[model samples]
Target: MDERRNRMDDARFDEEIAAEVLPLNRDLTLPENEKPRTGREEEAHIHERKQDYAGIGKVTGIAAVILAALSLFILPVFFGGAAVVLGFIARRLGARSLGNWAIGLGAVSIIISLIFAPFF
Candidate 1:
């Protein structure tokens, strides 16, 4: 259905944005030379970490997004609240893989939960 497609599109969009933002974010405090021994190596490291974050984030974000979306159709007993919390912690701890993702997903889960909480 159109709704499902829209959800997928949103997920994809979020993922792409996260992919871009997370990298620029990770190296914020580090000096260029200190980041990696060489430019190629640095790029590799950044790419590796980025992919890792993207994978984990996709899992967490997709889960939360699905649950949030389902809340509208099913019962609004929205799950994924925990994943959001984890993401926040990850974000705070410098675990880009976990943190930035958690923040975004947590926000979504919280918002959806608020919208659905009255139902349950």
Candidate 2:
């Protein structure tokens, strides 16, 4: 009886495994009408992506600088903090020089504002 039960269990397990397996006849290849992208096309796509990032970086860097300048006049903590954050983001996106300038200006604005806070 034990031997018969063991055979039945093994058969059920095999059936479960077979049901889970993918069919061999399914098509895995791409359609013949579509061709793979050429190297130049790929490069152009990558270049375009880089340009987009650079543009974004430039914009962010400019905004950061503006915020830093604003910090010198009003709401120094808020504007300076925003400038610093945007500067770091711009740096990560490839505007190194602008990001550096933004960071420096932000820091200076914050410090100057704090120092003069008592007088105002």
Best-performing candidate as measured by lDDT: 2
* CA error at residue 84 for candidate 1, angstroms: 5.0
Determine the backbone clash count of candidate 1: 3
Q: For residues 1-120, write the lDDT of model 2, one tens digit per residue.
A: 998788865624343334234333223344566456799988998888888899899999999999988988889889998999999999988899889988998998888888888997
Steric collisions counted per model? 3, 0
What C-alpha RMSD separates each model from the true structure?
16.8, 10.4
TM-score, predicted candidate 2 vs. hidden true structure = 0.59
Per-prediction TM-score: 0.33, 0.59
Where is model 2 poorest over a 10-residue stretch in terms of lDDT?
Answer: 19-28
Q: Write the per-residue lDDT of candidate 1 for residues 1-120, one digit (tens) a residue.
A: 998888875624444345543444433454444453588888888888776766565555555445544444454333445555555545543456545554565566567768766897
Runs off by more than 4 Å, candidate 1: 1-36, 73-120
